[model samples]
Target: MPRFFCCLPLAVGVWLFSLLFFAWGTVLTVVGWYGVSSYERTDLALTRRQLVSLIITTSSWTLLPLITLFGMGAALARSPRALKAYSTALWFQFGFSVGAGAYFIYNLFRRNDGNFVTNCTSRDIADRDTCQQAFNVLRGVIVAVYVVIWLIEIWGGVIVTQYATERFQRSGGGVQFSNAPPPQGPGPVILDPVMMPPPEPPILGPAPPGRFAPNASGRFTPPGGQPQPSFVPTAGGVSLPPIIPIGQSAPQGQYAFAMPQNAHGPGAANQV
Candidate 1:
């Protein structure tokens, strides 16, 4: 599930609770103002000092709660202004509660001596004591509320810090959140296999015959047949030269050489 979905209801609840405080503060402020305005300032009534103290107490109660309400609204809206406002409100509440608690404690201790409840000329003696007891009770309640507010402020501060950190990171600034895992580095690179072209087919033809073909010794021989003698052309038309063996002379009359008629004696051809 998304983080926002889980947190949405909690945010809405805080907003509603702050709204309740706002209403409470408004009612207290109205009541304080009404009491101050309606109370007659005659010498027989409540003294000026007691009236001023009452006004200060009521104003602190009213103003701090309203400030807390504004802080809660800023927190719910997730505004950047929330941090300062919430912190201020928390501090104000804490200071006011401590001061009021201390004053009431002193008042309680001095009640017998008539320090706080002495000037109640408009009310019965029993009612004056009841009023001091009520003030002490209210002071205790405010202190308790301050404690709750402090805890809430601490929790809200953590949430706001987390959100602000995350937002800063997303905007390409600040460091990562503590709860988030660190990122892994880059992965290994992959290379593609190379492709090659196909080989060509062998040529087809007839082989050479007989002497042109290679023998067992890989040498070629001439065609096998008897050798023919070559004839030469001369003035006597054509003639064949006698083949004499090496180192042997030709026989005197076994073969006759034909001489050209022009080279013979004048009557040698006629005589033959």
Candidate 2:
């Protein structure tokens, strides 16, 4: 049901199959060494020293299969730190296995005096060569296992980095996530960029020469040139309509009326 189940098994299969193959080689190492150490070419004779080396060599080869099983499995670790540690460990194990395998092979051929004929004809040399070949085969197998394990490690690392990055983004903590979405707000008011106020219409009337304009005293002058004075204050301090003064009559014929007897104060003659 989980993706990990399907993918994890694929990883495990690769590692386990490698281990089984190496395990087979371990069995062959013991048999080959035992045969060479105990049996002379003519009568299967073995010295006690050769017997001890055989046991030690076979036992060491067995360790290779176990390391392949456990170390390769560790490459599929879920934790980032653990996976890194596993990868480092596998590398170290791989190096040690290579060195041990090379040394064992060297011992096998060197003890046989570089003669394949003698190596195969002598019981001890023949068995030693066989044991050395098995160790060599195991070395190759373990190397291949590590390669596959590293592939899985790389893939797993990528997944971890991606998952971690996504988690940080959701929490507003990652490089591309801080201030990602500003708090919701009403949008700015958009004024029309190219708009302008309408022009004031031209007023149609008489030309400037015929227009009425206010004077300094705040009286309006008619365009016809009439002198329009402002109204003056009366004795009661109230504004009176613009008219001739009491003592000063209206223009000679502008007003038509009879002069009263008291026109000249007390005894003035009445006049129409």
Candidate 3:
């Protein structure tokens, strides 16, 4: 829930409100400078009372943004990196709010005979009394503008503080940031005989048409009844290929080689 408050919506709302007040204040200031409604009906006469009103009205425009800046600073205190910028904006906003508020209250207590003192008095007449009526109207408008500035600053400040609190709570009173995962290592390579060995040579043997003849040893023998080559044996008990005797050729369909087990010991060859 606290996390939710720190979201963009609330932050944007605060910014917008602050912006509105500043913008409105500027407009009011410009209009007051152009000679407001009260000064239009009067003969030309500029007085200190009207001058003060004018200065305050125009100053209020500058004051709004000042207050907004200060309020924004207070709002953004959570982010150390951005604190300086936020603080600057907040202070600016505060300055504007205070200036506008104070001037507005000052004008409230001062006025003239039926003419609320205003800032739009003309210099056509030398007497200060002539400008009293116009100054009053200007004062009223300036006061309203200041009131708006204060309200906006208050609203904006509340939003930022509340959001900051919620965000801190959600992060266990700390800041939470996400980081990317580390990369993975490459896979190991495996070698298999079937996948790596070269293609094998085709086995050569006789055609399948002949019937095999058997010798006295019950082994397949050549057509002439000759003794056939036998399989040899090796130390590991695996049979080695069979081999034909000298001067003899293997019959069809027969691979003439000795199995490993059939091979006699090394010196046994000399006995034979």
Candidate 4:
């Protein structure tokens, strides 16, 4: 019922691993039974070590099919509870694998001991060293096989766990992962030349004052004579703020102008 894309495939992978394990275990179980039968047919009775191996390996197949069925069914049905049960079964098998690996490694180390698995004390067994070497080699092979199975079990367990989780489900798409990335915001702002208003001309100096002059009269005029000034065009309109041109700078106390008419030093008031 999950929506993750990898759910179905990962479940199937787990199922396949279980199937492989069941088949391998069943084959080993059959081989163990055959070995026990072959030993029983011999005039020499089976050794205690051989008998123990036979008991464990022969009984392995009995429960493998049931466990495999559980895992495969859960995988196909996509049932979380069933998958969990299958994992629990695998945990027991994992325990067995660990025990078996330890036994084989120990057996390999003890191969040179006097009481080795193969009874070289018998008259027919002429080469005791050769027999021990062969037994050690067999134990090494079994250990290698167990190591491979351990890797497969780990991979299968992980796949099953992820498949059962909310992250992986049957619905299909390209790598359907959870939590989409946060929504992107608008890009940085940039000024456009066309949208900007044209720069106004800069102010050069204070505007010429407009004054009222006294009317022309022959009679003496009082000190409080009214004055008037004729209207004349001014050099600069100082009422408004100055605008600096692009790529140009001006001093704080001075305006940027090509020429100046203000007097300097002592002749500041003289027009000449």
Q: Largest lDDT belongs to which candidate?
A: 4
What is candidate 2's lDDT per residue for 73-181, written digit by digit as tens?
5444433344344444445544554555444444443443333344444545457667556545644674565456445534543433343334345455545636567
Which window of ten consecutive residues has the lowest lDDT sum in model 4? 230-239
lDDT of each: 0.50, 0.46, 0.52, 0.55
Q: Look at candidate 4 and tell me the lDDT of residue 25.
A: 68
Candidate 1 runs further than 4 Å off? 1-9, 38-49, 72-76, 113-272
At residue 18, what lDDT does model 4 achieve? 74
Candidate 4 whole-model C-alpha lDDT, 0 to 1: 0.55
Error of 3 at 10 (Å): 1.9
Query: Over all chains combined, what TM-score does candidate 3 have?
Result: 0.37
The clash count for each model shown is 0, 5, 56, 7
* Best first by lDDT, ranked: 4, 3, 1, 2
For all predicted structures, in order, the TM-scores are 0.40, 0.30, 0.37, 0.49
Worst 10 residues of 2 by lDDT: 198-207
Report the C-alpha lDDT of model 1 over 1-272, residue by residue, as the tens digit: 11323666434444544565567667767876776786574322334554665566666767756676676767566664463456556566647755654564454344443443454434554576675675566557756755675565455444444544443454566555487678989765432222222211221342223212224453322245322233333443433332334453322221145555676664344332
Q: lDDT, candidate 1, residue 3?
A: 35
How far does residue 104 in candidate 1 sit from its true spot (Å)? 4.4
Give the better candidate number (1 or 4) by lDDT.
Answer: 4
